[model samples]
Target: MHATPAPPALDLPAIQALAAADMAAVDALIRRRLASDVVLVNQVAEHLVAAGGKRLRPMLLLLAARALGHRGPDAHQLAAVVEFIHTATLLHDDVVDESDLRRGRKTANALFGNAASVLVGDFLYSRSFQLMVELDRLPVMRILADTTNAIAEGEVLQLLHVRNPDTDEPAYLKVIERKTAVLFAAATRLGALLAGAGEATQQRLHDYGLALGYAFQIADDVLDYSADEAALGKHLGDDLAEGKATLPLIHAMLHSDAATRDRLRAIVEAGEVEAMPEVLAAIEATGGLAYSRRRADDYADAAERALDGLDDNNAVAALRGLARYAVRRDR
Candidate 1:
């Protein structure tokens, strides 16, 4: 009879609240995990950790656990473990992407070089494994192991898709699922798992994570077309320059007439994003960016749907809000 309250705006206050909720335990775990015999381990770990990461993966874990009425300490430890996995991926990603700037700071690979970044990513991965073993959770271990493997596979898949403008939705989804979705799924699943949620609830958490991850990544691709360099922390149309056939580009090429399509192909194949204005105009004309945003909205809707059975609470509502924020964020 009455409408349920929508989640609050993901403004600074809310983001800060989420950060505060996650800060203490994840920070401690990072410090504990970064310790090593080699000095470069400490240096590389500190550089990336101190480089002002958003820590979204950990926030999702902690909040999802809180949403499910979990107050136990294990959630925090697992949340930190999720972040370590994410950070490791990021370090490796910078090297693979061969770019500079993350969150407005010089990329770890750019500052420290590829070898340091790659080796430190290995350190982070090993540290995460050690922490998971400490948790003594077979399910958790299985989830992460599968997730990291999926990520690695996704990276290669994306590289394969690069410079090829024919990448369609299915191809794009496969790349994002491995490169992004599994980690999100694993993090939220860990929360539900730690909460001792029923099988149904655990599945819902996985669904939410998967959908949210798709929304998050599709939005990022849209940002590459629309975002300003200063705010987005990367060059506009970087995906195009890198020959990444994300949804917008893939969709545009799929729908374009042969001449227009050829022009688009040349842009991607050329590997010169200096023509971003032209690319942006073409994508906008074909409504590719709008189409991408709409698909992201679809995934966000699915994410909210997965929360249908969660107990009525602010945290639950916040989780729904997060689904929207993933698509709506400008930066």
Candidate 2:
């Protein structure tokens, strides 16, 4: 049997060209900071780091800072800090969801066991705080500290919503807003803050990141249903398998008739894919995927709008490209 070909890379030439040097510095900082004397910690951290992701969050911070004419070295430290926080969450998230795959590779929890993954995740969190302290900027620390706390709350809220077929679009959006977008907002705003940008500019960047996060996450959820497993770099139906009623299911439930909705609820509650074909069919019939994508596009539009008053530069253009890519990416 032949191996399936990997999907084409996500288009990010503009972001790449603009952020290449900063990203390299971020990567170097990541490698330097992730080092641990403990064998298990080093092993687990290295494994996940090597697994490789687009590092988009840190890239956003770097771009936002440069776009605002920030020339400080502190931005680099903060960018690495944001990436560490993101990786820590992925570690814990996989453990909580019992996820076995991510980014087309075995998840840390899957490869290293839940105990190791969780502990290493804790290590990353602590290390990130240590980096935060290095900056000695109270406001930046406060934003990250509050953002992390909100993310925890979002995780708990999502836990409550699991297997709950009645989870509404508003409830789901709130969860993503806290769990994901808050951090994105912090990342972008921190850049503006580092540059000593005025309150208005900082707020605009914050709004841009917040809207971009929503678009990015909603598009991600849609991919769970609409993308091929190889292209998605994870199993299709993973969300359904975990019994999470994300926006696709939420929209499908609302649009479905009583009988179809009842069936969908059963699948959600049972957390099984035995009825996946039927559930997907119902979602397709009711235009769930289309609805979700439309919602994502709306957020992307909001992100672009947030950039309207920013001075024109390559970094600003890259930010716009990133907003477009948020909704358009295949993985």
- CA lDDT of every candidate: 0.84, 0.91
Write down the TM-score for model 2: 0.96
Regions more than 4 Å wrong, model 2: 1-11
Clashing pairs in 1: none
Per-residue lDDT of 71-166 in model 1, one digit per residue for the tens? 556887888788988999899988888878788888888887999999899988888888889989898889889998999999999999888877
Tens-place lDDT digits, model 2, residues 102-214: 99999998888999999999999999999999999999999999999999999999999999999999999999998899999999999999999999999999999999999
Which candidate's lDDT is highest?
Answer: 2
User: Considering every candidate listed, which one attains the maximal TM-score?
Assistant: 2
Q: What is the lDDT of residue 124 in candidate 1?
A: 87
Candidate 2: residue 250 lDDT (0-100) = 91
